[model samples]
Each structure stands twice: as C-alpha cells, then as structure tokens.
Target chain A: MSFEVEDRVAGATERLLGEGTPFTRLGVSEIANAAGIARSTFYVHFADKSDLLLRLAARAMDDLRDALDRWWARRRSGDDRALTECMLRVIDAYRAHATVLAAVGEVAGYDPAVATVWRARVDRYARRLRLELEEDRRRGVIGAGLDVEVAPFVVTWSIERTVAEHVRSSSPTEDRALARALSHFCRSTYA
Target chain B: MSFEVEDRVAGATERLLGEGTPFTRLGVSEIANAAGIARSTFYVHFADKSDLLLRLAARAMDDLRDALDRWWARRRSGDDRALTECMLRVIDAYRAHATVLAAVGEVAGYDPAVATVWRARVDRYARRLRLELEEDRRRGVIGAGLDVEVAPFVVTWSIERTVAEHVRSSSPTEDRALARALSHFCRSTYA
Candidate 1:
C-alpha cells in the first residue's frame, strides 16, 4: 500500500515537472492532489519535494547504470563496435528520461538532499568505471599514462554533460554521428 | 570613482561567497558594509547580487578563455606539452575564483539573468573551439569522422565540469597528473 502511494506521487511529480512546473512553485498540497491523496500522506512518504526528487533521480541513475553495464560487458568481449552501440543506447535512455533528469539537475545545485543523492550516484558510477579501466590497464588493452585514476571522472562528466545538453537543446548532429564520434573518441583516448 | 566602487563591491561579493554565505542570505546592506560603501553607492554600480555574480562569472569565463586560447596556439604550433600547461593554468584560475564561480553556478539555476549570461559564455567558447577543430580537420591534422559539429560541445563541457569538480572537491588526484591525463585525453581524442 505504501509502495503504491509512492508510485502515484512519483508519477504525479514527473507529470508536474513535465508540464514546466518549477520545484519551488510545486506545493505539497498540489502533489497530494495530483496523486489523489491527503497532504498528510505526502509527509508520510516524503519529507519534502526534494526528497521525492531524490527518489526520481535515483531511478534515473539506475537506468543510466544499466546502460553503462551493457557497454562494459560488450567492451569486455573485445568487440570493436561495442562503444558506438553502447553510446547510442545511452543517448536513447537520456531522451526517454530527459524531463526527470533535467529537473534533478536544476534542483541539485541548491537542494542539499538532491545534491547528495546525485553526487553519491556519480561517485558510485565513477568507482565502478575506474575498476573496469584498471582491469583494462592490467590486460594491456588500454595504454599507460592515461591516468586511470582520473580518466573515469573525465569520461563520465564528458558523457553526462554532453548528452544532457543534447537533450535540452536543439541538436544538429544525428544519433549515429554522435554515438560514432563519442565511441571513437573514447576508444582512441583510452586504447 | 565608479570603477573603484564596482571593484570594492566585486571584492566584497567574493569574500562573502568564499565565507560560505549563500546567495539567498546575502543582501545589499551586507555588501555595502563589506565594500565600505553606502547602500546607495552599491545601487549605482550594480542592480543586485545576481548582477554582481554575473559580472564575476563573466570575469572567470574570460580567464578560462585566455587559458584555452594559449592552449590552442601551442597545439597549432605542435608544442606537445601545451595542453598540460594550459590546463594547469586554467585549474589555477578556477581555484582562485572557486567561491564566486560556485555561487554563480548555484544561483544560475533560478536566476534568469545569470542563467542567460552563463549559457552565452559557454556558447561563445564552444563556437570558438568548434572553429579550431574544423580547421584541424580541414588540414587533415584531425581525422574526418571526429563529429566536429558536436565534439566541441563535449570537449568544453569535459574540461569545464572536470576542473570545476576538482576545485570544489577534496581531490585525491595530483595537479600534474590530472593535467597530464586531461591534456592527453584532449590531444588523443581531437588532434
């Protein structure tokens, strides 16, 4: 029953944000109304809107992680085309969840809870990515002096910022071209 | 006389932000006291705190552009170490203005003027960087499939976000190593 209310609230939050409602203007009462619950129920499920945004952001991060995992697996198989394909999937996912991701990004700077959640997710992804790169370095697939320690930070930020901008703005380049360029750049830089 | 007032106000803003005063809590009176000016004088030089931050952010962007310009020249001259040196200089500037930049970034999400100013600055940088990459591609220095149209967006974002995080975080990576890695990544991926 609790999970059901949380789901409704999450759905309502996404709908409100999708309709261009800024978080500050989004009141608890409105959220509860949209979710067809009492305002008190919102408190039961979420401390505040920021708390709810964190939940949504966490969902987005999970989707992102799934995309990265696929890329890692294909990359481990030594398929030359893996990176390009991986990037395409990632971009599609970004498009799919652009609204929620955009809201999370806007709120992340000032909202402590959202910022904490966002940073934790990025750190988790970076740590996992670093481990993979270290393995590649050990196997001699990737070259030395690549700063495996720091390269993952650069890689993840680059990909995230680029895709976010693409989704938010009017993109000139097509999907395949972007994926190809990113894949080529990553492969050449690391390997 | 006017320039002096503006300078003092700018300095005061930086100090306040550096001391961890959130923009929401900063007021005209506090700024006047810090700058040793009357509240009326503060009005003459700027509209509000957000306007003051835009000026500061503009200053930071200029410093960043200067660093990138030097890097571009060295890269064109085929000076192998240019990127590392350029990135180090950029990182130093970021550190110097870390507090103000952080403030600008935080307020930018909700402040329309600041957001507009920040986006314009990024767009200017990206456009310049794109022209340089196109020139390289035309000369066959950079390969053709680089997605010159989209690569600059990625490159500028990568450098900006990476440096910003490095300045804002308790970084485990050494300065020289980080510079080397980023320089290597940019060189290998683009040139």
Candidate 2:
C-alpha cells in the first residue's frame, strides 16, 4: 500500500477508536468513510480486519524497537540516566499508538494469531536484551552470580510490563519514578 | 456441591481435556455424560459452562495459594534452598490441576471474568510478597536500594510468567534449573 493510503487507514482507525468502537467491531465501510475512501479501496488494500490489526501491531512494534535501538547504541554501563531515557522513549513510542495498542492487547490475549505475532515481537526484544547482558557480563561488571539466561528475561519483562501499565495512565513524574525504580533494580541486580 | 459430585465433575473435565477438547468448546451435556450424571444434575450445580470454569479456577487458585502460603510460612530471607523448594511445591500444585490451569490460561487471556479473578489472586500474592520484602529490608538483610512499591510486582511477575511457561511442558531437571535460575536472580536483586 502507498504511504498516503496507509496514513488514511491509520487516521481512520484512530478516529474509530476515539468514538468508542473496538477494533474488532469496526466495519470496513465505516473505516473507508472515515478515511474518505471507497469501500472497494479498503478491500483492495487489505484482506480483512485481522490483517489490518496485524499491520498496526507491526507498525507500533517497529516504532518501539527503533526507539529502544537508539538507546542501546548509546547506552553505558551503570549510567542510570541512559536507561531512564530509554524507558521514556519507549513510553513515548507506546503512547503514540495507544488506541491501537489497547485493542491489540485485548485481542492478543485470546486470538492465537494475534498472540503469536505479539509474542514474537517481545521475544525479539528479549533476544537483543540477552545479547547486551551477555556482553556486559564479559567485562565482569554486571550480572555477577546471576544467570545471564534468566536475568535478561526478568529485566526485559519488568520494564516492558511496567511501562505497558503506565501507558494507560501517565504523568511525567510518575514515569520518571517508575524508570528510577526499574533502573535501581536492574542496575543493582546486574551490577 | 457435594465432594463426590465435585470430584466426578473434576475427573470428567480432566478426561475431556485429556481427549483434546478446549474448555470453551465443551458442552454441558458432554460434561454431564462424562461424569455419569444426569444433565439436570449438572445445571442444578452449575449455571453454565462459564460458571463451571470459574469454579475450576477457584479450586486451582486456592490449591496453589495454600501451597505457596505453606512455603512462605517457613521461608527465610536469602535462603535459596527455601525459595527453590517453595517453587517446587508450587509446580507440584499446578501440576495436580494441569488440565484446569491450561484451560484457565487460555480463557483468562480474553475472558474478563476469568482474567479479573486470576489477576486479583496474583495481586494478593504480590501484596504479600511486598510485605515480606519490606520486613526483610527493615532487618537490613535485603532490598537495600529498591522501591517496595515496584520491585514486588516485578519479582512476582518474573517468577509467575516463567513458571506459567514452564508448566506447559515440564521435567524435574528443567524445573530445578528454572527454579535455581529464578532463585539466583531473586536473591541477588533483593539481597
């Protein structure tokens, strides 16, 4: 699909969510009308609602991964500020598509297809986190007496689950506090 | 319901699950037939399949909580062996109702009623864990630089999620390794 068409769908989806319609309940005609496009164009661009949701999930996951990648590239050992900034960036990425994420969260719980796609993305992040922890352990600075195998998953999910919870209701101070708590635990455990 | 009736239903549910029927797909008549009870007897006890599921969840959660409570009663701070044994007991309780827990895991993902009950139980465990951590911190044995508010939730979920994953397919060696990995991480983080 063209960028312009994709943009239209994304905008329409958001409006639908804002109006209290669930993604699962959204009709293709409503989406097309909201996007000021023909119904036929909707079918031409996507096969079904499930496909659209998967695409939205992909878009959001990509955005989140990109934000984290930037943090990982510049991160330093024991640098609390770096990790906090990384979490803040993650919160921003998730908040950017809050509506889509909310819908995805609900469906991913029950739908095998959606759950599989979502879990695969989480695993990708965990894999990268494991690699980073492994590298940190080589320098003998962090992860003493801790299994690199297990600590990474715990730490990754700690921040991921915590950040996901905060996105639903957020404040700058609260986010900062959360990041601090997580950074303290992460650094202390690994260091 | 009488203990005999409950036992029969539980046995029938296990047999159904063992034969590969998803809990949500199970029929009231089928359950009644498998239990060797009249269909009227089933309705007299359960309002519906949903009610049956809720009861099954309650039974399993209670069993798991009792096992954990016993472990917590004997738990000593920084005792890796104690924690490992606690997890082993938890694994055993869950294994006892493996059929029901598997069903609950799937439904709890999407069913609000099931999810609410499951989360509330998890919250109970987290609250208790936080209290224990606060006590240990006061004793100056662990949790030197962590938030009582956040760390408990993370630790609870880390072990909870890890255990839930392991329950699907398990071995004594694998469970021991998992328990040890968790014990090591938990000890280092809080100690």
Best model number under TM-score = 1
For B1-191, candidate 2 gives per-residue lDDT tens digits of 67788679878987997675767567888999999999899888878776788887788889988887866665664467888888788878877777787777656645667767877887898799889878877877775567787777666666666666566545655676666666666665554
What is the DockQ of the complex in model 2?
0.34
Model 2 per-residue lDDT tens digits across residues A111-188: 667867877777788799789878877877675567777666656655665666566545656766666666666666
lDDT, residue A182, model 2? 62
TM-score of each: 0.89, 0.79
lDDT of each: 0.78, 0.73
DockQ of each: 0.56, 0.34
The candidate maximizing lDDT is 1
Prediction-by-prediction clash tally: 0, 1
TM-score of chain A of each: 0.87, 0.84
Where does the lowest 10-residue lDDT sum fall in candidate 2 chain B?
Answer: B164-173
